[model samples]
Target: MRITTRRRLTRAGMYVLFFAVLAVVILVTDWGRLAQQFFQLDIARDQFPEIITIALKNTILFTLISFVGGLVLGIVFALMKLSSVAPYRWFATAYIELFRGLPALLTIFAMAYMVPIALGFRVPGGQVGAGLIGLILVASAYMAEVIRSGIQAVPKGQAEAARSLGMSPTRTMGWIVLPQGFRIIIPPLTNEFVLLLKDTSLLFIAGSTVLTKELTTFARDGLTNTGNGTTLVMAAMLYLLITIPLTRLVAVLERRLARGR
Candidate 1:
């Protein structure tokens, strides 16, 4: 046989062996009992209303608020970082690096605990508000980088052409560069939003009221109440339900962008 044929057969045999072992393990394991306890529909149904109100609602709210906040700050920072102005560039650079260098959990904790103590003023939702602020801070840092890269990816020729047509720098950026840059960045930004959706789970550490609780907290509370993991499984499914459509959108955007390339 040819060497290529032999190699293909060897790879196929390895895959077959892997699946055979997987099948044996699944058959030997108590998966039925595991499913009965963890995937109990009655327990999930009992917890569904609270899960929808607190977990799903709050998770969506956090994501939208953080994304909007991050997007606004991200645009400002991206422009500043790209500017010829020294102080603006320095400030934007420092802000981006400072937040990006820290772990997100640390930022969330500090915002929740340290900010209130230092400012001597409490926000509306207390810990949850603080957590949302932290999410915005961290997300803005990442988004600033993404926006900067997108802006910079616009060809210098495009700017020059706009200038030659008597457009001011601000107008050129607004009318030409940003529109193209945003198109290029859309898929990655969508992926970032998906990440932000998942990262909202970290807010559980900041403490939440019953209505303010996100998916992780809701699931955890249910786990305690029922002594079963049904809620966790349900929450996982709900997250998948929310995320899967966005993921497909990202895939479509990526494909379209690739074709443009």
Candidate 2:
């Protein structure tokens, strides 16, 4: 009859229903078939050493290369976006808008295949390199906005105070504004890194040799060779192993930043 008693009864009923469904699923599911398809010990074993040495190594390498390249380009565009010169602003806006609006896969495909045919330009590392360049372009567009916002969030007073002390605008921005902006944007930038790490999987569309294969491509190779899905599962687990900690770090940094504010 009481409100608290009714709430408790509702909660109890929900738990019962949840367990009933879970029990039914467990009873009806064929775990042996699932294991054969996705958890075969021999297939998983075959992926060892090479998966770690080649696949995961390539994934991390591509991510670092893309992030560094993207960060440099993003900083340039972010500054251009904030420039008083209209042409600089226009160019920056166009670049950011164009790349961000396009799918990353399409962009990578264009770089890997279309650019070579259209312009006869061979990116330094072949198709893999072209894919990396595409990723950098896409990443720079997103990061430019993040950097620009971070720069704008820095207090105007800070800049004014520096200017009053006879510091040049460039000097003030370099010495004062940028460091503060970077600190403010660290969490978002880290979040971006995690996203980019996962985005390396898209490079598979550009294709790879056994040597150049990153995680997704390597898993596909494993799938083909073994005819079991265990390699896919292994690759997924490795990805989670890398990403989970970074994601948790992002959350921690955000909370700390909020508390500081």
Candidate 3:
């Protein structure tokens, strides 16, 4: 009846219940069927070299392009959002709100199909280009807010110090505030990179040539050809291989930043 004894008994019961459920599930499951569907080594082998060289390569490439494009545009939008000029603030706000409110898939579809048709403009690299552009636009909207918060988080004293030392407002912001703000925001930015990496899977909606296909498309194609889930499993593993390290890096950066603070 003591509090500590009751707590230990409850914990032991929870553990027992968890194992009981797990044992029943394992007993009822068909290991042979599961292996045939998702763990067929021969089917998995067929996807080899190309899965890594082509599918995964394209995923990483698309992510890098989108992240770099987004970061540059995000910085510009963040600056505009903070600008003294009313029009700049208004435009930036409208853009951020619009993209943030829209589903990324819808935005990608529009970029790939609607915008080009309406404007009679061709996006270079065709569908792939438009998909990347859409990703950049969505990413910039989210990142603009991140960058804006980071910039605002910088101490006002740093800007005042720079101004007192004869730096112009622009110079102070560019040299002092922005750099310090970036340092403050590195952990979140790294986390954004991980999210963007996963987001590259959405590019399959825009369609791709075999050469440009990322992991999801590649796995789906493999599934169609092999009629096994192994390809999907392989693709999932590749995604984990890339994202797990980046996520761990984000945690490390956060801890380091906290220590610095």
Candidate 4:
């Protein structure tokens, strides 16, 4: 047989085997039990308005707060990392390495518990505040690297042109280089935002009031109260609802950036 014919036969066999496995799994699954556990309409209904009004709201709010705070601090750190001053560079490097090396869960736990104990004072908004601080720290470390790469990716010719036009170094970076860099980095930044959104689920480690609980906490509480996994399914759907669009947007931005390049 020709090589092409052999390859086609192999491909056909793989496709047939894949569908055969899928059919077997579908035939074996207890659809009724699965539906009762994960898709009970009544159990899901119990979570309705509060899930959207409180849980989803808090998730989005926390993500935005973390992203904004992280973006600001990340810019400062990126600049410090890029600075000619040795102390600034060293401090920035240490911070980035320390946070990036640690698990975000540990960082959040420490911020929520350790710092307050060490300082003999409470973080301003309580546990939520401390968790937010931790999220900002982790997000900043990652964003700083992203921003630094973006800054470095800006063409040296752009800076030279600005300097030739008598623009001060600071002014040139602030006005010209930074803008272009941000444009180049938008897709990555959007991806980071999506990550932060999911990370809000980790905030349950910090503890929360009924009003402050994000989706994971809310769904967990619902699971305890209702004894059905439907709440978890609902939460998963909501997460998909938010993340899928943002991820698609990231893809679109990346494609556009690729085309622009």
Candidate 5:
């Protein structure tokens, strides 16, 4: 057989395998039971204004505050990592690697509990605040690398032109380089926000009041109260509603970048 014929046969086999598995799943699933358990609109309705007002609001608030905090921290560290000063570079490198290597859960736990116990320091705003700080630490670690790469991606000539125009190094970075670097980084930074939004679910580790609860904690409590899976499904749907559009935007930005290039 020719190479194209062999490839065609392979593709046909894959389609057959895919549909066979899909058919098996469809046949095995009990649609009525699934809906009864997970699609209880009556129980879902009980979730009410609180889910939207309190849980989702807190989730969004946490994500925005952490993202903004992380962005600022990321910038400082990124600059430090690029500094001519050896100590600054070393400290930045250590911070990024250490946080990136640790689980966000552990960091949140430590911030919420251990810091207060060991250091005798109260993390401002209590457990929820500590969780946000932990998130900021982890996020900044990742964003620092993104920012450094973005800054480096700025054409050296742009900085050179600014310098030649008698701009100080700081002024060149501030006025000329950072604006372009941030533009180049917008897609990745948007992706980071999506990740942070999901990570807010991890704040469950830090505990919360009803008012402070985010989606995951709220949904877990609802699951207990309703004794049905509806609230969990609702939480999943809400997460999708928030994430899907952001994910689509990332793809669009990537495509636009490709086209521009």
Candidate 6:
């Protein structure tokens, strides 16, 4: 009882210290100015719709395209990495490491300027098209790692069992390993989608026409028009609105996967 009492006192002291620090910070900072800039009501209403239409839409579009592209390419990369052939594994590993190490913005810039110049070809939607391709490349690297791990997580016995049942190597992998691996990958893949949604903001660096401008760009334009920061806040809120649901979905998937395991 005495030890318990002492522990309670220590906990209470930590809380008091935290509150004291918070009070000092509040007193030292310009709370009124921060509130006025970030929480201006009329400005939020004026800019929020535009933020939603441009930023939210583009973010969703980028994530969907990148997720689809990554899913397809990641599966192939994972298979290559798992292959018995030396060159396939080497090529897959090199591809994954190269894109994973590079910044998404640099990749987008290359796709926008360097690729087009080198190839002497126009990307269909100009900067937007280039940005999406860049996102797909970067996303594929990380997704490849996720998929490789998932495929590896499957029991070796499952492959042997399939082969014993007269399944060819390709058939065994297609029928047994991939389905189980995909189930294990679902939660992490959803998390990757959430990350991709946030990363779409980097597209602004590649530049876009007004119609193609995403959330950050749209908010910046709104800020310039209204001379207020409310647009930025609105953009943040809309991103949260979309991402929060996906995050919750990820949690549910994790629980389901855990239970299945």
- Top TM-score model: 4
Clashing pairs in 6: 55-215
Cα lDDT of model 5 by residue, 1-261, tens digit: 999999999999999999999999999999999999999889999898998999999999999999999999999999999999999999999999999999999999989998889989888889999999999999999999999999999999999999999999999999999998998898999999999999999999999997999999999999898789999998899999999999999999989987987
TM of each candidate vs. truth:
0.96, 0.95, 0.98, 0.98, 0.97, 0.92
* Candidate 1 vs 4: which has more lDDT: 4
Which runs in model 2 stand beyond 4 Å of their true positions? 1-3
**Winning model by lDDT:** 4
What lDDT score goes with residue 36 in model 1? 83
Candidate 1 per-residue C-alpha lDDT over 174-247 given as tens digits, one digit per residue, 9 for 90 to 100? 99999989998998899889999999999987998877889998998999989999998998999999899999
What are the clashing pairs of model 3?
Answer: none
* Per-residue alpha-carbon lDDT of candidate 4 for residues 17-54, written as tens digits (9 for 90 to 100): 99999999999999999998889998888788999999
Give stretches of model 5 more than 4 Å off: none
Clashes, model 3 = 0
True-vs-predicted CA distance for residue 76, candidate 5, Å: 0.2
Model 3 ranges off by over 4 Å: none
Q: What local lDDT does model 6 show for residue 66?
A: 85
Angstrom error of the Cα, residue 95, model 5: value is 0.6
Better candidate number, 2 or 4, judged by TM-score: 4
Q: Can you write out model 3's per-residue Cα lDDT over 1-261, one digit (the tens) per residue?
A: 999999999999999999999999999999999998999999888888999999999999999999999999999999999999999999999999999999999999999999999999999999999999999999999999999999999989999999999999999999999999999899889888898998998998899998999999999999999888999999999999998998899899899999998
